[model samples]
Target: MSTRRKPQMHSSERARLDPFIVATGDASPRDQQDLMERPFFSLAKAKRVTPILYKAGYVQVEVYAVPEHGLATIWDADVLIWAASQIVEAENEGLRTSRFLRFTPYQMLSAIGRQTGSRDYKLLKGALTRLQATVIHTTIRNGENWRRHQFSWINEWEECVTRDGRVEGMEFVLPDWFYRGVIDRSLVLAIDRSYFKLTGGIERWLYRVARKHAGRQPSGWTFDIPHLHAKSGSQARVSDFALDIRRIAARQPLPGYRLDIEREGRRELLRIRPVKLSTESVGGTVGTLGTSGAGGIGTSGAAPSGLRAQDTQLTLWPETLIPGLNLESNLDSNFDVGPEDGGKPAPDGAASRSDTGRSEPVSPDDTRTREAQP
Candidate 1:
């Protein structure tokens, strides 16, 4: 006679961890635009072990990508956007938000406009892995001493699964650096929905650049091709980089910005201008600038009573803008308008001429200005 003893369940198997909970409500994700200024991630899909060291006078950023995990890409930024938007929305609603967020893969994928298929789910997991693996060492927030602070994009993450081995949701903790930026409010901005559709990496990067630098300003910002190349931390040759910029300019794929290529002497420059607002809105009371003074574009002339110029004549990385950083000397040479073109004043209200002794706009199609709403 076989006596079957009652099976005793192991304590570990008996204990069921409670799933993380999130407040039931709408999600409003926002991304800090300041991040676009630095090259914290790789633009390519290929594995990148080469560390990127970017130096412009006192401003220095060092990025190290793990060989096995590769560097985070612009696409991976969607995760941050989702996180930021959710946090912001929660804060606005007086709801609680935490670094450890509980969300199903479908929720995240759908929010970011990614397909919720199994393959896409796998890709989402890979993106999280890369974000956690890629390390960034910078002096961005650190003061004059140049004490390097190292941190990954994501601190830690875990997947919640059901008894059937089906993924129920995921929880990830954001690094302090990113979390602080998002809560600051001033560092965040509202981006266009069309931003997700940009296919090319450079085009996406360029859109961020435009949003960060140009914003809703009409005057926009100008960057020398060489300087932009160096700041981008791209492995491509300068010529190739210039070609890509030209292509992007031709397409005008960026939502709120109008791109123009002009020659300043032998130097090629990319001008990013914001699309004008509608006449009806322009007539209304003056609208506030969307970015902090430290990171906003300057205005030119006195705008209509309620309207103001979005452009400014100041340089991007001036010491005044980023205290303890001295970029004037390093960038002066690159941005210097050659003496050859100094005497010739560009046509009034027309495109400015470059030092290359050629004052004409590169693409006629870019000359027509378009209107966009923020």
Candidate 2:
């Protein structure tokens, strides 16, 4: 009898169809870190931000949110950080990493130093939803010709459930743009775990700016206060924005960076310097990771007293006070605004241009401002 025999599948073929999965055990090693150089997430609170278009020079960024759903905040970047860390770790271990990542809620929350409570789990889900829903239109990686590309932070995601209706795990696909950036070794940088402890949004944004610009260079970087305001994409008035910078400088909270305030002919400049590893080990206080020096300059020995409490405050005069300074000229002169020429290596050694352009600092006549809500 010609019985229809079921075709046997090869083991390799079976594995290709259903690969074995690993659980995040306590002993699981943490992954290397990665951060996006360009400003992607909004620093303002989701509740306060409106669907707005931010433009500086030739670069333009548009952020949109649904009616009930608010825009993604800087805190949402935590998810990206976790994803980047995992991908980099996998690449380093010679394991294949993909857009589709399977992970438990606990694994993600714990890795980012977030609490593993039920509320935190719900919050995580909400963050994921916002990330998926928030749409961004930008000319970042697009060439100088003004082409626009649009994408969400995440492409798609879904959760797995057990027969008992308990959530088992989740899987999400990252956007190709973000994935490509993470996989490229040059685009990634290691940040201190203490970054999570930062309490202010401006503080968090400033740290990213410092990391992207100063990198590991001993000389660090300098940004004019007015220019920095223009680059922050903040809706705050220039005076208030500058005040926030002063307050953050007074606290000296950012990890791996030292803040110094300088004055040049009435122009106030914020200088960010990389703290030496040795100095970090000796003086870092927030977490075991490293040091805290609000006023003292790093190895550069510029001036220890420059950023002291007294010196941290900026003095504004009406004539030099160019509120909402013109960004077109500043963008071209002070920063690298053009896309990577494709052949030349990026200054920071990254394969791609580290930043498209600095965010235009917002200027308003009113000095009064509201503190950003958490």
Candidate 3:
């Protein structure tokens, strides 16, 4: 009877694992939680090195930024991965990160800095080289879903031909876990182009500021520029400049704080509202500059006295996108009208052009008017 005994029965039967469940489980615990609700990069592991996924279209990448343990904001990548992890993870859950994540190098470059044939370019190349060395190869599809993955570092000054001028740029992705950890509370301040040019590279300067302010509670910082100017007049009176400074400061994440501006013999003070404004709030400030008595803000000191709210104009920085950082896309898609013959066939004995001038052929309206008179 023992030899002929049937297989023993079990109290519970094993169930087939749900692929969906397994898929969700694959992501790191820290990555599953909503990042917006809780700042990523606040965790202990994040405090050590972390990864960030930044994609600009078909181009997906993962980059690592090491937080100096509550000391400084230096995100030097130790590893770079192009797993398209977010997309892979999203597919498992029947979703995807926003389409904005797709590769759009032209757009990506517009955010970091303009393309210049200078040292800044060298720094960008160096950064790219460092990134290439760290990237690892991996795929995340299901059974029978094999796909090869690879990423080529963009060569410097390669033309990214958008409808607008071929802009220059680069981008790397950050891992989800890394996203939730270090860059959690990172506040993106859209530096107005005018402001950056005034200071010569505002984003770079702000990165330095953020690095300096890293790990500390947001409190106060001072701007001690030699050529600080206010919209009021050439003198750059503190009172005239105070409102704009305070307006700019108020948009920052810091709250319940007062900002005091001082230059030479002028000082003006303003307070940050308890509620922080989104980056768009800064855009509205441009409207204020045009309509408010701050009219002179953009007039280059010619129209200083025209201070009326109706005259407010939004003096936005040349739109810059910071991927996860900037809320505004800051994309410029205006069409430039070239000469009728495709740019004034060189000014070789041609008319003195006005502006980036290209002379257009005589208008049909003139011919029509001449015939109508007969």
Best by TM-score: 1
What tens digits encode model 2's per-residue C-alpha lDDT throughout 141-212? 455454777888877666655555444556576665566656656556666555655655678778877766
Q: Comparing candidate 2 with candidate 3, which one achieves the higher TM-score?
A: 2
lDDT per residue, candidate 1, 1-374, as tens digits? 22222212223211122112343344543456547656776665456678889854334578887787677776777777777777677556554344545456655666655655665666777788878888888655444343566888887776655555556656677766676666655566666655655665677678777776566646666788877887678888999999999998987777667999988688788999878522121111211111100001112111111002112221211223222322342232123222211223323433422211223211222233323323
TM-score quality measure for candidate 1? 0.67
Predicted model with the maximum lDDT: 1
What is the Cα-based TM-score of model 2? 0.66
Candidate with more favorable, higher TM-score: 1 or 3: 1
The TM-score of predicted model 3 comes to 0.23
Rank candidates, TM-score, best first: 1, 2, 3
**Where in model 2 is the C-alpha error above 4 Å?**
1-37, 143-146, 162-165, 277-374
What overall lDDT goes with each candidate model? 0.56, 0.53, 0.24
**TM-score of every candidate relative to the true structure:** 0.67, 0.66, 0.23
Each candidate structure's count of clashing pairs: 16, 7, 39
Q: What is the per-residue lDDT of model 3 for residues 1-374, given as tens digits with 9 covering 90 to 100?
A: 01112111122110111001111122210111111111111112113244434321122234343232221111111011111233334444544232122233322222222333333344334444433333322221111232323332211112222244332322233332332222221211111222211211122123223222211223333333322221011223455444545445544422222334444354332211112322221222211111101111111111111011211121111122111322121111112222222222322222211111212222121111111100
lDDT of 1: 0.56
Q: Candidate 1 — number of clashing residue pairs?
A: 16
